[model samples]
Target: MRVSVILPAKNESEGLGRVLPLLRSVLPEAEIVVVDDGSTDDTAEVAAAAGARVLSSPYSMGNGAAIKRGARAANGELLVFMDADGQHNPADIPLLLARIEAGFDMVVGARGASGQASTGRGLANAFYNRLATWMTGHRVLDLTSGFRVVRADRFREFLHLLPNGFSYPTTSTMAFFRSAYPVAFVSVDVVKRIGNGSHIRPLRDGVRFLLIIFKIATLYSPLKLFAPAGLLFFLVGLGYYGFTYSTMGRFTNMSLLLLSASVIIFLIGLVSEQITALTYTRPDRP
Candidate 1:
């Protein structure tokens, strides 16, 4: 199979210098494409020097935008996406490829304890993994690892839904699960990034990751989220009504409100579940 290796870069000339060489050595037959996301430095030049086809954006779009551009330009049946910051080891490429060859629609590089940049990041990843697992009913080894191999055609289907930011990995991973595609994860150790600093802001990205919870609910199973919430309100209303009737021999407005809200929320969830199913269903082609 023709494979394309896509590296998304932004002011990552130094890291690219080291990463591109290793990729070339390990994946000699693969097409390497480096997307320079409006880097002020010589990132495009560095990638060109390392024999990688360069795709330069006029302005800084985002990491995910770069990925989309590279995917569009690549002429491969399979696509591999990895960081340009040297955190991903090129040697692990073969492992992901092997899993993909074994009939997996997507193969992710599952980061171990040693792979995280910090304790906080590790904890955050753990939370994401658990949330994804709960959402999909399948154990998620990693939720945000950038190193992954995906079938080109399958990956392209959700291009319009992908955000133009750092959370593309999260979006794509959840999407594959919702679509019922075969996915696998292989443990991999990550190295320290070569660059001076990371572009991700913890506070900002943390909030964004939190929003992924809603995406997970909407993507795979909206009822999983809405049902529990409705149930909570329903239970609370019932309890309050019982307590009030026993004490004051009266039905309170608060109890009625809660009960009404619970029913409304549940009905909305049922409608949403149906919509979600229709949205994801592939229409028959003539």
Candidate 2:
């Protein structure tokens, strides 16, 4: 299969200087396209000097934006996306591609604990992995890893759902699962970034990542989130009603309100589930 490797870069001149040559050595025949996300530095120059096709953005759009642009420009049946900051290893490209050839529509590079840049980020990734596993009913080794290989056509199908920011990996992974595509994960070791510090802010990206929990439910299975919430409310309502009936010999207004709320929440969940199912149905299917 024809393969195109895409590297999304934002002021990553130093790392690209090292990574491009190494990447070329491993996949000499593959086309390397670098999307420079509005870098003021010499990122575009470095990529060009390394003999990579560089696509420049006028202003800093976001990581996902760069990815989308690169995907659009890549001319290959299979597309590989990796960080330009040197965190991902070029040798792992073959591993991911091998998995794809083995009938997997998408293959993700699952990073180990040592791969994480900091303890806080590691904990966050673990939480995301667990939550994704529960939501998809399949084990998710890494939900936030940027290194992955995917069939070009399959990846483009859900491009509209991808965010403009850093959460594209999470969105795409969940999307493939929801669409019933075959996805696989392979363990890989990651190294420290060679250039400047990471762009992700813990407090800011933390809230964004938390919102991904809600997206997981909406994308793969709405009932996973709504059902639990509804059940909790229902159980609390029942307990409160029981207490009121035993103490006052009558159902209080609070009890009536809680019971009504429980019903409303459950009904909402049911409706949401139906809508979710409809969205996933293929246009080609009857």
Candidate 3:
């Protein structure tokens, strides 16, 4: 089977020089597509010189935008996405694709780097993943892995759902799992990034990452996210009314506000479910 490997590059021309060659050696028959995400450096030239088909974005769109662009330009049935920062190993491409071939809709590479980040960072991701998995009722082994292989046809449906940021993998995984698609994970070695520095700032990007998780959780199953909240609010409203009436023996306006908000949020969850269902429905489906 032909595989399309999409590398989203931004100011990584020098690094691409090494990554592209390694990929060429490992998966010779696969088509390599590099997306120049508005890089000021010679990323386009270097990618071309490395024998990669380059898709140029005139300006620096976000990482997910580059992925969507590269995927659209790819011609293979299976699409493998890798980071251009040299953290991913081309040698593991086959392992990822093997999982896909074995009948998984998506195959993710789970890096063996548990302490890869700081204690706080690692713990945060672990908690967030568990919470997301619990909310979606799907087993999520890795929520932030960029090294993955996905069916090009099913992967295309997630392009629009992808936010223009570094959390594309997490968002796509949640959506796929929410839709009941099978995802498998392969353990792989994690190498240090080859470039000078990482583009991520743990402090700023960490908050953004948390927000991304919330967005995905809400998008896939709003009720799963809001239902608990709605229940809490409903209970609070009822308690408040009972306490106020028992104390003063009179009805109050504040209880009305709390009850109203509870109903609104619950309605929001119902509306979100309908919209989400309509978004994925197909006439061809039984």
Candidate 4:
């Protein structure tokens, strides 16, 4: 299958200059698509000169938006996505492709400590991995790595489900996993950024990242994230109702209100699950 490499860049002109030449060497046969998200610098110009088909958004559309734009323009059976900030190795593309050919719908470039990120970011990433793995019942060693290879058709189905922001990975992984799509991880060395400053802040993006995970979990399979919680609420309400009935020999309205509210919340979760499915389900979905 033909491979397509999609790079998302925003004001990453300097970084992209160094990244493109190496990428060309590693993936000479693949189609290279770079989406420049309203970069004020020479990002688009540099990418075009380096042989990548450039697509520019009129304004800053965010990382996820750039990815989607590149994907739409890509023409290959397999899609390889990587950051243009030069944190990912182009050499790993072959390894990712090899795993994809082995029948996995997606091959994740799991980050390793060898050339990984900052200490604060590393700790947070580790925490995210643990929480995500527990939630999805699938080990998620690198919950936010930007480098990955996915089957194009499988990825296209979830295009509308994507948010035009940095939380794409969290949502994509959840969607594929919730749909029972096959996935595998390939270890990769994450290099430090090639530029002056990182766009993501450890404190800011990390919290947003966790919230994204919870949101995705809720949408994917509400039962997995909410059932236990709903059950706990219901039980507490049930206990209060029983105690009040036994003590007063009458059913208290407050107790009933709590019980009703608990059940309603669970019903809301169930309804949300159905709505989430519609985002990627077949045309004949219920």
Hey, what RMSD does candidate 1 come out at?
1.5
RMSD of every candidate to native, in Å, equals 1.5, 1.3, 1.7, 2.5
Cα lDDT of model 1 by residue, 1-286, tens digit: 9999999999999999999999989989899999999999999999999999999999999999999999889989999999999999999999999999999999999999889888998898898899889989899999889999999998988888788998889888988898889999999988889876889888778888778778777777889988999999999999999999999999999999999999998988899999877766676511
Number of backbone-clashing residue pairs for each candidate, in the order shown: 0, 0, 0, 0
Candidate number achieving the greatest TM-score relative to the actual structure: 2
Model 2 per-residue lDDT at 170: 95
Give the residue spans of candidate 3 off by over 4 A: 113-115
Model 4, 1-286: lDDT tens digits are: 8889999998888889999999989878889999999988899999999999999989998899888888888999999999898888898888988998898998899988665567777786787778778877889878777899999998987888788988788778777887778888999887778765777777777678668757757756776766776777788888988898889888888777778877887888788778777666786533
Candidate lDDT (C-alpha), each: 0.91, 0.91, 0.84, 0.84
Select the stronger candidate by TM-score from 1 and 4: 1
lDDT of 3 by residue, 15-60 (tens): 8988999999999998999999999989999999988999998898
Candidate 1 lDDT score at position 198: 88
**Cα lDDT of model 4 overall?**
0.84
**C-alpha lDDT of candidate 1 relative to the true structure:** 0.91
User: After aligning candidate 4 to the native by TM-score, how far in Å is the CA of 75 from where it should be?
Assistant: 1.1
Descending-TM-score candidate ranking: 2, 1, 3, 4
lDDT (C-alpha) at residue 208 in model 4 = 82
